[model samples]
Target: MLYIFDLGNVIVDIDFNRVMGVWSDLSRVPLANLQNSFVMGEAFHRHERGQITDEEFAAAVCDEMGMALSFDQFAAGWQAVFVALRPEVIAVMKQLREKGHRVVVLSNTNRLHTNFWPGEYPEIAEAADKIYLSQEMGTRKPEPEIYLKLLQEEGTPADRAIFFDDNADNIKGAQQVGITSILVTGKETIPAYFANNPC
Candidate 1:
């Protein structure tokens, strides 16, 4: 059996809104008000793909705000709100891998977020036979094409693969492509899904 997991809310605690709040306080940039012009999806996508460096992204925001802040300062402020991984989630992932399952991570994340993953949470990455990250793949979830691409690359039949995610829409997207799925609300509940099923 192959187990695919989402990274962000599934593995770690993240509040991008909190990061923006902290950034606004420190840099005097009102990210909320500049939603359309600065903090929209395209700007974030460029930042994620490294098309724009953190420094460049910050400068763009600063330009809109008529303020200036260094790259180091921006990075520090942006990273301040993130929290650690839940122990239960980590333990369950390791257990899944130990059972000889082909476990992998399939996450919709920016480059910055993916960069922060390794070393800090090696267990999560190591449990995976491989990882499929959105930024690297240039495709995000809740999109059928990405799921099809993953199935092709992993060479795993859709029905034999099980995907776990915190979002219902992503779960739906997986189902649309014939990949079985579970909404990971808690760790204790996950093991039940693995039972009574044969790959």
Candidate 2:
């Protein structure tokens, strides 16, 4: 059987709220208001795609929040907020591979994150059979097209394939495309699923 997994939040813990909290203190803005303006909007997406540089996005965020800070200061502080992997999750992926499952990673990360991945986590780079990064593909999750691309590339029947992701919408998208789906909740549950539901 083939298994597809989400890279961030599922495999690694990513607290965007914590990053925003740091930005809030530096920019002297309230978290609730800043999130409404930038978090839900396309400011981050545009920045990730290089449509706007990090400095430009920081400036825009500052302008919207009615505060000021140097680009270097904001970038350095934000980069520091990202955390490392939980080793238990890495062990789970390695065990799945040992059982002969084709394990792949799918993430909606940008160039900056992808470039630093190998340095941050060598195990993921070495163990994953394949990786489908949205930045390179120009697509993101909850989009049927991206999942369809994975299904096509893996050449696995929908019934024999399973996907584990944190986002409910992405899980639904995988199910809609006929792939078996699991919402990532615990590291132990996945291996247990394979043992009982082997293909």
Candidate 3:
């Protein structure tokens, strides 16, 4: 069986509040305002969909927040959101691999995150058979196209694959594509799910 996992808040810890805090401190923009203007903005969606370049996204964020941070500075603050890998999840993935299950990462993330986390957590990069990112795929989760793309690229039938993600919508997307899916709620739930399901 094939096992597909989501990156943020699933295999790894991520805090958008941290990103907001860093940007807030650097730009002097109120957290709520930043969240509203940038986090919930079209620029972010465009960037995640690979519709815009990193420089364009950074510039848009800076213009929206009225900050003057350079591209490198903005990227630094943006990449600060990832905390660490959830070791238990990594262990589960390793166990799955040992048992001969194919494991892969599917995340609705931009280039900055994709570039940063793998380097920061080499174990995550090493754990997966392949990693699929939204920016590279030109599609994001909760969208059937990306799920279909993954199945097509991997030559895995949807019925033979299992997907785990923290978002209900993403899980629904997988289900829509006819893949078995689990809605991961917390770190402990992963091992419990594995124990009950047994791949």
Candidate 4:
């Protein structure tokens, strides 16, 4: 079996509120307004798709939010989203590997985030046999092409793989590709699945 997992919110905890809080302090934009303006719009998607530079994304965000912060300040707020490692999910992944199942991570993330987290959450990266990033792959989640590409590259059949992600659309996308997918809502997600499925 090939066990696929999403990086943020699954193997590692992420809080967009953390980003909001930091940016709010820097931009003085009020949390609510900042949250409202921080839409995952075209520019955000493009950044994750490796179609734009980090500075471009920062400028787009700044323009949309009416912020005058420099790129360094923006990057700090962006990196604040990551909180810590999800040890429970990491344990399950390790067990899955011991059971002879291959594991990998599929995340829709940008270079800034990609460059930052691995060092802090090295175990999460090490737990997986390989990590797949949307920015590096030039494709993001909820896309059929990325799923097809991952499966082909890993030489894993759709039916033989099970994917866990926090996003509904991403879950649906994996299901559309004929891979069993679980929506991770809380800590019990990965553990409960492993308890019942044992794979």
Q: Considering every candidate listed, which one attains the maximal TM-score?
A: 4
Candidate scoring better on lDDT of 1 and 3: 3
List the candidates' TM-scores in order. Answer: 0.78, 0.80, 0.93, 0.98
The 0-to-1 C-alpha lDDT of every candidate, in the order given, reads 0.72, 0.73, 0.88, 0.92
The list of candidate 1 runs beyond 4 A from truth reads: 29-40, 46-68, 186-199
lDDT: worst 10-residue window of model 4: 190-199
RMSD of every prediction: 3.5, 2.9, 1.6, 0.8
Over 112-169, each residue of candidate 2 has an lDDT whose tens digit, in order, gives: 5665666777888666899888766666677787888888888877898878887888
Worst 10 residues of 2 by lDDT: 40-49
Q: Candidate 1 on 100-199: residue-level lDDT in tens?
A: 8778888776555555667677777666678887767767788898899988888889987888898899999999999989897764545555554533
Candidate 1 has which clashing residue pairs, if any?
none
- Clash number for every model? 0, 0, 0, 0
TM-score of 1: 0.78
Off by over 4 Å in 3: none
**Over 4 Å off, model 4:** none
Q: Give the per-residue lDDT of model 3 (tens digit) for 106-127.
A: 9988988877787889998778
Model 4 Cα lDDT, one tens digit per residue, 1-199: 9989999889889999999998899988899999888899999999999999999999998999988889999999999999888898888888888888899999999999988998888898778899999998898999988999999999989999889999999999999999999999997888988788764
Worst 10 residues of 3 by lDDT: 33-42
For candidate 3, the lDDT comes to 0.88
Of the candidates shown, which would achieve the greatest lDDT relative to the real structure? 4
Q: Between which residue pairs do clashes occur in model 3?
A: none
